[model samples]
Target: MKYQFDKDFLWGVATASYQIEGAYDQDGRIPSIWDTFSKTPGNTYMGHNGDEACDHYNKFKEDIALLKKLGIKAYRFSISWPRIFKDGKYKLNEKGLKFYKDLVEELKKNDIKPIATLYHWDLPQILQDEGGWSNPEIIKYFVHYASVMFNALGDDVEQWITFNETSVFLYLGYLYGIHAPGIKNLDLTLKAIHNVHLAHGETVKLFKNSNYKNQIGITLNLSPNYPYSVEEKDIIAAKTNDAFWNRMFLDPILKGSYPEEILNNPFGNTLKEIIKDDDMEIISHPIDFLGINYYSRSVIKHDENETFKYKSIPQDGEKTSMGWEVYPDGLRVLLNYIKENYGNIPLYITENGAAYEDKLENGKIHDIDRINYLKRHFISAKKAIDEGVNLKGYYVWSFMDNYEWAEGYVKRFGLTYIDYETKQRILKDSAKWYSQVIKNNFIEE
Candidate 1:
């Protein structure tokens, strides 16, 4: 077996508040968009709501114990906006603040570095009602909330991610109506998208001025666009899609401007009008690092009549339980692509894991498929590192199975399988395998 990766390479697991922290109405917490969306009939799978997902809010100590056992170096989790800002009001909830204050202490006691995400799709319902990410004023609310967290937990948490998967949440929530605060309107979605980046800029500025010696960055779920064929039409489609999805978010932060190709489009032009003076300058503020969540590549073909002027061609290969193609080499390609295009900066595989129909037999989950998925991705990451990609760390998508958004609890994407009935976490086979990878500081291949 060959080994790769620097000795200090980070190994960790990530979880979001809405997905794992059930206790929807406990201890001064208010409802988030997720709570409202999941509870509404026909919004989620089997009417599944995250009312009692993993109960991590009440079981933080036990969860930290699991991280210590796994030998993980870091733990990436999000701060629930609603938890701190009940009903999206300006007032901060002391109990909500206490919960995270205690969680940070527990993580530090276990010698685990904490990566805190300010927003992870759990928007305060009050904010959503007032146009949420769509409203430019929402920046003020986000900045205020971020400031509170920075002052409260900044000393303990050195790494902070402003937003998680900006495109996914906005597209799903505003355009597709599949996620929280569901609303289907392409025009509104476009405005919301641009403003989301603005919010990111505001948060970045807030973190930098906090006077805490900390590293701040934003996490974008980047999808590499590949042409479906050698035809000129396909090639053009791929480029345009790349600008639409990848560049729209990346270019703004790194380059401080939107791609001309994206801004010139009829829809993209609409996004242009929303860009106010000094907005790009604010968004372009230099940050400490960039976290990318890569799942798979998109193979696109030109479509004159279709929205976004491109259509996805079905990928042919082994697919995950989420129907994402199992393409480990794509991870290496994407990592190199980011380094080549975005310049060498510290980058972390903030979220990477696949959903699978896992089963528990004899008090264990024999998820060999998941183990293979992670092993291949790990090797792919190492290949990029060997080629001079400044890849710092990789955090598996989830620590345990919990509410999986629209799919509810059906899709299991965790190394540790959670028995929903008893809230008992059974470490899957992948977890055991990952423990060794962490201990070795490299993937054995």
Candidate 2:
């Protein structure tokens, strides 16, 4: 097919620790912020928690078998920070480390490259009690945690992600209080954002300087911002929204400085104090690649009453089960934007998939909508690559349906259907189609 990817272009699937690894209390593993947040009344959908998730911790072999069946080249999974630090004291949890070593070994045996992520929003509850990401003191602890993982799994896991979706966790956790360690304080949110960026930089430096011969990077959930109207005010609103949503996080890492427009903006002014001498230098350490999670674009309009002065307007188009717009071309726009602004840095669509109201029929799922979503997005990615963007690979958002934070088990984003009750995973029609894509290394249109 004309939509073929390069031979080296990796195809993979991703899953987070809290979402899939259900052995929450096993092997001396302690509670993560998710465990605490999900347990609280009215925190998650129908109060559903990830107490048993997909039981991947216990069924990884089965899951990996399914992954092998899909003919993917790599598997991107995160380490449960709490699992390794069980006591929150930075003490080595050999048992916890062993689990990941085993997981990596299994992936390797199956000829799948293991892309390990250090943190996926599953901070130990004990750390949250000690101010979590908001407190600068947590940086040392995070670095120590990274050091341990590097020493333990560096040999087996060649690709490492320092953090996943920093904007989502920081915004939802600190500003909106909709996530773990939830607190609705603007000051705390700014502090958490700065600290997390600092933590990522420090960790990247550690990994790059080490003798592992592996690659390290961070994953960001990014979207292209568009104006709701041709009016200058609306255009300015889109720019402001872009500054807040995209540049605030991107500039610090790629350019070694926060975007000037955002730094002067009212919502971002408070970050100036949180930023310290040489902090930006540390936050902008060079990395091997950039992981981008693109799902939708934001159409913004000026709203003087809003805190950020830009409000998101709902678009008239097809939307996924998660209420996110299905704008595949946004992937091309976002990738090209990165290339144009950030230079030709290597990039990966680390997490991109649509959630749909999937149902099981006759022991199978017919998720044509999800298939279409993925196909269009893949085509967009191919277009960007053909246009000279250094787009490297694509990993579907999830391997199977798990505990979707806040929304809980309601939304299904998996190529494989997970029967939450029986824990039986049946390959959806989309999975069958994706298997062929991976097998052919192309989108067969």
Assess each prediction's global lDDT (C-alpha) against the native: 0.88, 0.91
Clashing pairs in 2: none
Q: How far is candidate 1 from the true structure (C-alpha RMSD, Å)?
A: 1.1
For each candidate in turn, the TM-score is 0.98, 0.98
Best by lDDT: 2
RMSD of each: 1.1, 1.0
Worst 10 residues of 1 by lDDT: 83-92
| RMSD (CA, angstroms), candidate 2 | 1.0
- 238-284 in candidate 2: lDDT tens per residue? 99888887988999999999888877867667898778899999999
How does residue 159 of candidate 2 score in lDDT?
88
Give the TM-score (vs. native) of candidate 1: 0.98
* Clashes per candidate, residues 3 or more apart or on different chains: 0, 0
The regions of model 2 sitting more than 4 angstroms off are none
